[model samples]
Structure formats: C-alpha cells, structure tokens
Target chain A: MNVKAMQKKWLELGVEVEETEYAKTGYDFSLTLPAEKVHALAEVMLADGFYLVFVTAVHALPAIEVVYQFALASSPRCRVMARTAVRADGTVPTISDIYQGANWHEREARDFYGVVFAGHPNLVPLILAEEDVDLKPLLKEEKNLKDISALRHLPAEAEPKEEKAPAAAKKEPAATDKKAAKPQASN
Target chain B: MNVDVIEDERQHQFVLNMGPQHPSTHGVLRVLLKMEGEYVLDPQPVLGYVHRCHEKIGEYKPARAFMPNTARMDYLGALIYNQGYAMLLERAAGIEVPRRAEYIRVITSELNRIQSHLLWYGAYLLDLGAFTPIMYAFDDREHILDTLEDICGSRLTYCYCRVGGVCKDIDDKFIERTRAFIERLRGRLPMYEKLVNGNIIVQKRMKSVGNYTPELCARYGVTGPLLRAAGVEYDLRKAEPYSVYSEFDFEVPTEQQGDAWAAFNVRYREIEQSLRIVEQALDKLPEGEVMEAKVPKKLRLPQGDYNCSVEAPRGELSYYLVSDGSDIPYRIKVRTPSYSNLSVVPEVCKGMMIADVVTSMGALDLVIPEIDR
Candidate 1:
C-alpha cells in the first residue's frame, strides 16, 4: 500500500499518526502509540516494504521512550518513526521476529538503558560485557533528565494542543522505577 | 585435567572460535562457529570488543566536540562519517552550509569512499590468499590519502568537518592535486578489473558463494553494496540525495548475482562512479567561503529530535540526535551501517564452507569499530 493507505491503516489502529515536514524533522511521518502496539506496527511496516532503520530509546521524565525508525528502500522515499514508552515493568515487545535486524538493535538498547525486549531470542549485551550489563551507562542523572514534552519537536501543523497532558499524567503513576522514567512533573 | 568442549546435540558437531585476533575475521571481531567438519552450522558474530560507547560519548560532549568521535567510528570512511554528523547538526540547528562547502564535501566524501573501497578490495583479496593485489590497491589508494591529507591535514580519523562547514578551506593546489589523483586512480581501475575480476580462481571462490536474495537482504535491513549487489538499486545518494549529490550524474552500480562476486563487482564499479562524482564536483566547484560565518560559538540545538542519514562506504550511516535545548546532546544514537550489515552473518554463513565464510564476511566489509561503536 502507498503512504495514504498506510496512514489510514495506522489511524484505524487507534493511535496518534501525524505527518511532519521532511525538511525539519527528517521524517515524513511520526506516530506515538502504546508499547503493546509496536509489534503490530512492525508487522505492518515490514509488509509495506519498509525496512527497520534503527531502534533506540530516550530516558525522559515519566517514561523511557523507545523509538524505532523505518524507511522505504525504494524511490519517493518515505521515512517513518514510531515511538512507544517502556511499560511499568521496563519491558517492550520485540520486533526481532518481524525484522531480523532489530534483534541486534534491541540488544544494544537493552545494554545501554536496560529496557528489556520481552521476546527477543538473544537479548544478551551487544555492546557491553556480561558483567557490565547492569551498568546502564546511557541512563542520565536525575538532575539532567528532560521532560518528554520538551524533547519532541513536532511540526506546528500536526502538534496536539491539550491531548498530551492527560496522556502524560496517566503515564506517570505506573512508572516510578529508578532506571526507568522518573516521576512525572506537575502538568 | 578436563577439557570443556561445546558440543551440539547432533553427532560430530563442535564449536570453534574465530578471532578477536584471527586475520580473516578482520579487526577484532569474533565469530562463534558451530561447525560440523568444514561446513559451518552457525556463525554467530560476537561483537563489542572495541565498543567505546561512541553514542554515550556523544551525550557527554558538546555538539561540536563530538566531531572527532564520528571519525573514530569508521576510520576507513572517516570523512563520510564527519559529513553525516556535521549535516545532522546543521539540519537540527538550521545552519546553512555554503554552496562551495557542499561541493567540497561531495568531492572529499567521494574520494574517501574510493579510498575505503580500494582498501576493502585489497584486504578482501588478501583474505582470499592473493598477495599482489593489495600492493596495487594500496599504491592507488596512497594517492587519494595524499590528496586528502593536503587539505584535511590528517592521514586517518580526520576531524576536518565542523558543525556548519569544514574546519579548513581547500586551495588551488589542493584542487590541482585532487584532479591529478582522480586521473591517476581512473587509469588504475581497468588493470584491477583485468587482474582480479577476470581471474578464474577468484571467480570460482566468489561466484555463487554467500548468495542472498533481495527480499532476504531487505528482511535483514542490509544496505550499501551488498543490497545493491542483490539488484535492489537502493542507494541513499540516489534515493535521498544528501550533500548536493543530486546534481552529480553517476550511476548506482548494481549486480544481479547477490553473491560475493556480485558485491565485489558492485564496489569495484563504485570506485569508478565515485571518481565520476569527484570530477563533476570539482568541475562545478563554486567560488565562495567554505565555512558559514554566522554560526554561533556555543552551539545549542532547539528542543527536539533530529536525524539525518548519509551513504557511508559500508552502508547508511545515520545519526539520531535528541537535544533538550542544551549544548550537550541529551542522547545521540549512531546507526552505523556495519552493525546491520554484519547482523546477517548467522543466516548467510550457515551450511557454507568455512573458507567461503571469510569471503562472504569480507564481501560485507565488516568494520568492527564501526559495528561495536
């Protein structure tokens, strides 16, 4: 399916899908969804001729935001980014079964921020030693962490006005772990 | 004394370790091989030997301070890495590079690409037990290094690129030397084609070895010459057209076989195509300042995430920068090409001869530092 059709499919999945300016964001489309739907999104992306570009995470207030980027390999290239926050238990579903390349990426993410990929076949440390897995070197000190709202540079046309507030408030109570997201700042 | 052997449940199956030191495995990469005699049952590439946490370093340093770290990731294609990071920050901060600076980036990056390919050509042949071709390849590559060294002022791991533009400008002598080096390298290609590509032993070893389908490559997210060799024709330079590459007329050379031979031919032809781009960029070289004058001394990116990808020699080298309006990046995820390129090892090396494993891995151009970083 083309981009429009794919956008409709994602909208049907009951997630917030926003198209952004490629010049500014370097991504044609961006979506924010719950962590559970990422596996389904990965399946749809793979079927739509999109390849996994990279998988990374950002440690922000209220959530550890897991990010996945996909790009169309062919022409009229469209780049898509899907982000989901880590669950309260610090686990997210693995897309390794969907995209084999994600296996390594997920492993690297786990090595850095300690966000576990629940179903990854080999979730061993990819860039760190076995003993150093618990180091979680990329995790920021509490004073240095930023709010999720402050980091997303969404385009003006697609920016949501007040919907983000309630969603973030609900995200705060469940995630109070140290290595995961800190408590939500007052909205 | 008891010997601990890692034996598979199947009869006569044993595990072998290949390098963090072995020559054929290249640059500090270890492959855990599940072998049954000569055939590899599985080749699991164990990485992280040289992992310096380059991305973690990106978080600690200021935006401009991280420039040198980019080159350290892939020393062979250092300039391309520099260009990727520089363009990424430029895009984030809305810094416009000069017209002449873009042309200079194109010329130098393509030259870096050719040097990377030349080294891969020689090193790959050495992995296949050919001694003489490396000498010829390095002899040709030295001219490229000299030309680049004149303007960039470093042989390898060059920190030439800055946030908005290059650190230094190229003079008339640099241009003349680059032109001469381009001509010299162009003359050497045909002989390489005749020497390596036409050899029957090389063909016998390379052809039909490590064959992967386009769909398989896409599934694995493989890019660069390996993907192009599979007939995908998906080059970031052609597909995305970053750094004034759209103006240059050159082909993304491809081969249909999807084997080591095909990858070899694709990279081989890529050298010629890079030379074409360098020549075109040099001819169309604009007259202007190389550095943008108005860039802020204290570089602070707006609050957001910015990502940009450029075609490195191994594949798509991308930087995902997340800034919280700080001079220091909150997080920077480096998506190095070799990491993904080598991820397909277990699937590709299974049931293949042990000797062909080296050829296949060599064909992928595994840079351990880049992968580990």
Candidate 2:
C-alpha cells in the first residue's frame, strides 16, 4: 500500500499519525503516535500480518525516541516506521504481547539505553555484565568515563563479584618449589 | 563398588556440557543438554564465548568501515551479508550502480551461495557419521575460494563489494575461469550424489527425521532452503526481485517433505539453479565501469529508516538501518536468519535421539556467529 492509504487507514482506526518528514533513500513515512496507543498500534499492525523487523531507540537530547519498524510479509519492500518518544527518565509500554520477535530486541534496548519496557516478561541484561558500568558505549568518551566511575562507587555489597580466578591465571602452570629454584638459578 | 553405586543413585537426568570446543557443535557453541538416557530432556544453548560485540563495534566505526565486518558474521555466506548491508546504504543514499557492476555482484553472490552449500553438504554428511563427503566438498569449495581471491584480493573474509558497486572489475580470464569451474563442478556433482546422496547410511540417518511442516516453517520464519524443503514456493529473488535478479531466469526448488532428507534435496537442487543464474549473469554481463562514479566518499544518508532483505545461503537475512542525516547510522539492527532457525531447534528435537539433534542442526545450517551477532 502507498503512504497516503496507510495514513488514511491508521486515522480510521482512531490512531493519530502525523507525517513529520520525508526520507529520500528509505521509506517515505515518519509517523508519531501517542505513548498510550503504542501497543495498540503494534497489535493492529500485527493483525494485518505485518512483520516486526526491529525495535531501536535513538537518544535525542530531551527524550529517548523508541522506533518500532514493521513491514508487510507479503510486500517486504514497503517499510513503515512507528515512533514514540519516552521521557529521558525511561518509561515505555512493551510490545512483546503483539510481536514475539520484540522480546529480545526490547531486552537489548533496555540493557543499552536503560529504557524500561513495562510488562516485559524478562528485562534482564542480554549482553552486558551483571554490574552496570556505562552501558551506553556510544556516549562521548569523557562522559562515559564519568559514568564508569559513578558506577564504580556503588556499594560493593549491592552487586557481589563472582569469586573465580582470572582466565589467564587459571591457565598458568603450577609453581613447584623446584621450578621456583630453577627460575632463580636462571636469573 | 556395587554398594557405592547404589548409594549414589538418586536418578534424575544427567546434564551434559557439549562444547566450547567440540567439532560437531561448530564454532565454539556450547549447549547444556539435559539428557534422559539417550534422549534430550531439554537443551539450553549458551553463547558469547566468541561474541566480540559486533554491533557495538559497528556503532563506533564509520559506515564504510563496517563492510568487512559483515563477512565475519556469517563466514559461509559473507557475500550476502556484504550485499545486504551495502544495498541498504546504496538505496538510502540513492547511489546508482552500473549494469556491469550489478551483473558482477550477481555472479559473485551466486558463487558464494554455491560455496556455502558445499560447506553445508560436507558438514551435514559429517553430522551423519560420514567423513569422505566433507573432503570431497572441501576440494570443490577450494576452487570457489581461489576464483574469488584472484579477483577480490582476499580469500575468506572478502570485503570485495562497495556501497555503490563491487571493489574491482573482472577480466575475460576471470570470466573464462569461472565458466570452466562451473563446468568442472557439473561433472563432479554426479560423484557427490554417488558417494553421499545415494548412500544407504546417509538415507537412514536423514530420511523421515526432523520433519518440519509448512505451517510450522512459516510460523518460525524459516526461509531459504529449509522453508523451501517444507514446500513453500517463496524465494526472495523470485518473490521480490532486487539487484537485477529479475533479469535472470531460474527456478525456486522445493521439496514435498520437510524432513532432513528433503532439506538436503532442496539445497542440492538449488546449487544447480544457482549455476544456471551464474551462467545467465555472465552471458548478459554489460561492459561498463565496475564501480559507480557518482557515489560519495562520505555517505550521509537522509534521516529515515530502511530495511533490506537478501536471500543468504542459510535463509532470508534482513538488515534494518536507521540514519539521522549523519555519516554514522543512528541505529543498525541485523535480523539474521540463523536466530529464528536456531530458535526452532528445541521444538524439532523434542522427541528425537541425541544424534538426530546434530544432524537436524547441520541440515538447518546453523551459523552460530551469525546468530550470536
């Protein structure tokens, strides 16, 4: 379907959409929806047999814009992007109910940008270490260092470090008394 | 000894740690399998041993710099990943590639598909307890690698394709060599059928095992040979033509049964179809500049989101790139086929023996790096 028909259908469904800008290279439509209607919009799209390609969040200054990209399975080329911005403080409704593929993508977004997806079954860290340490790797270098230090100041008891020998040390040969003496003799 | 054995027998299920290094697991994938006798009760796959955070690295690097890393994700189908990423950018930036460049892209991509299938054939035979087919398949794959290296200047991790077009042009000698190679491969395929495909041992191991119906295949988003094996006449090239594929004539091979044997047959038939595509692309190759002249040194795509899907050897590989009118992409999401294909393993392996899991996974052509990335 063309952009005009898509917008008209979306309007008929009681979902408000505004065409913010036109992109030359990719899909034509840039839609903005109310935060409360995000999940409903995704459900409607899913019922229409649209496939959820991915969910990504861009860190704008005042708000974190979470964009859910979809396309019809029959017409895979026609792309549609639905975006809704949550406050920088982080609160957004989850769409895992609508699309099963969104489960992992939501977890990834949460771990990286700290965007809390409400009602997500599992929001645990997908890639990062258990302890938070500047999860935003793309942040400015100086600010990242500051975030790292701030993370380091958390009470040690809050997050217990696993007690295991370092990987390199685990591979070291056992130090016998004879080997120690031989090392000294060589020196 | 009998008393001690009796005392220790509480009799739950044994947990077997398959590999961080086992050969059959393929590429450092470790699976914790809960076994009840010889059958798997449940299996949990643990990754990240080889994960270098490719997405994070791509985020830091410039758009052009990430082209080489595309090959690293699915080492077997490197050209498809390269094409998918490059095409997404090319479409976004509105860079027009010459006809000659598009033909070369098709030729190399088809060659890469053959190489990938050869590797899969070898690996699948190995999974079924035969070792000779692997050696035979590798011998054929070496020829493809040699041909690609001669033109692209690299063998395994080929960064040959560029944003608008391929990195280099092919000469008459390269074309002649590819034609000779295809002819040679056609002669050897009968030998492959005799040694592996027609063998009774392989048939016993693969036929009627790990059956995935067409409905289940669609539900799981399985594509490429696996979906075709399930009787779905869906190929991205024929369904939604891109990169001058519509110019070529080829058939989408499908099989009746979605069993391991059917998957193998679909891939085998696909190799023949790919050979036909390569021949057509070579004959119809337009003589012109290999790389487009108008493509920019620094690509700044307009602010928008683009999704591009290509038929990788394994399945349909999709790349979603969002640009904010900057040289660097705002968000890049790769929906690799292996992720969905691998997700269906626990379902397929539910009532099968431990050995069937290996064979089924091999037939599915599970590329762990692609999945983990």
- Model 1, residue B149: C-alpha shift (Å): 0.9
Give me the iRMSD of candidate 2, please.
Answer: 9.4
How many steric clashes does model 2 contain? 0
Q: What residue runs in model 2 are displaced by over 4 Å at the alpha carbon?
A: A1-13, A16-48, A71-80, A86-99, A128-187, B1-11, B211-219
lDDT tens per residue, model 1, B40-129: 887899889999878888888899899999999999999999999999889988999998999999889999999899999999999999
* lDDT, residue B78, candidate 1: 97
Could you give candidate 1's per-residue lDDT for residues A1-187 as a string of tens digits? Answer: 4778999888888667877777876888888889888888888888888888899989887778899999988887889888888887778899999899999999888888888888888888878888886778888887887778778774455543434432322433356565545312110
TM-score of chain A of each: 0.85, 0.64
Q: Using alpha carbons, what is the TM-score of model 2?
A: 0.81
User: Model 2 over residues B78-141: C-alpha lDDT tens digits?
Assistant: 8878888888888777788888988998999999999999998888788777888899899999
DockQ per model, Cα: 0.69, 0.11
CA error at residue A12 for candidate 2, angstroms: 5.3
Tens digits of lDDT, candidate 2, A17-101: 5442223334434456656777888866765555565676655433455777665544344556776666323567888766655
